[model samples]
Target: MAATAAGAFRRTPIERSDQRVAWDRTDQAFFAAGACHILAWVCRESYSDKTIEIVAVRLPGQPQVFHTYAAWDGWAFDHSGWNPEPQLLAVNADFEGQPLERLKITEGLAEFCQKHHHRTPDQYWHDPRPRARDYIGRYIPPWA
Candidate 1:
């Protein structure tokens, strides 16, 4: 299901995100891979009823952030689809032996949000908007 949804995405051109992201590669199958912080913010605002929070992680000794996503109800959602949070964390932490620290509330995500997300912050400093929200439905499964 996640893969199917990912298939539907037309990858956003990542020029702006280059200044914000730290991930070594953005050629992953998930369209949001390059702009995870932006897409995650979109998902969080679009599904406010789910009480989703944006989250991110860093390499063990590196300050640079990576792999942003939305979390709620012990589950996590990204362009790839939804998965149990623990499983997702485990996979994200050690994918291809690129281990990372535990997920953290997206405190470090503000700069990305500020630059790319152009929505009313609600309470956030620079939450993103409509286009991201519009893109979200394609990834939401019925059970979710």
Candidate 2:
């Protein structure tokens, strides 16, 4: 089990190399998935300052999407001061009928971050909004 700053511990299965890139290059969009997974792990482990309220997704080829929500009760993060209901982080992409593949990528990214440090090189580790933006701008667009 891995330890987190909020005292939350969880175990994740390691991924194989083939499962890492199962999506087609043209229609596969794992940017948001990767971001959310990494952000969740980071928030749970290193920085428990601001709670991740919600993660909403609107994919291009999927009928039903996925959403994740978290709340702060003084032990972790409290973004309620900025917004009464807590702001959500939305991820728009096209899974291309490869939901399972997308999930693998997300999990892989989180595990990779947990084992390796990708956020340390970043200057804005404390801020999620900026870090998300930078990630999309720098990595997501290029991958797409």
**Total backbone collisions for each predicted model:** 0, 0
- The stretch of ten residues in a row with the least summed lDDT in candidate 2 is 1-10
Candidate 1 lDDT, tens digit per residue, 38-101? 6677677666676788777667887555567777787777756677777777766555266667
lDDT tens digits, residue span 1-144, model 2: 111111011112321122234122111122222233334343334334544333223344553334222223322111111122222221111213322111212334334444333332132223344443333233211112
Best candidate per lDDT, number? 1
Model 1 steric clash total: 0
lDDT, candidates in the order shown: 0.55, 0.28
Which candidate number has the best TM-score?
1
For model 2 the TM-score comes to 0.24
The positional error of residue 28 in candidate 1, measured at the CA in angstroms, is 7.7
In model 1, how large is the Cα lDDT of residue 65?
A: 56
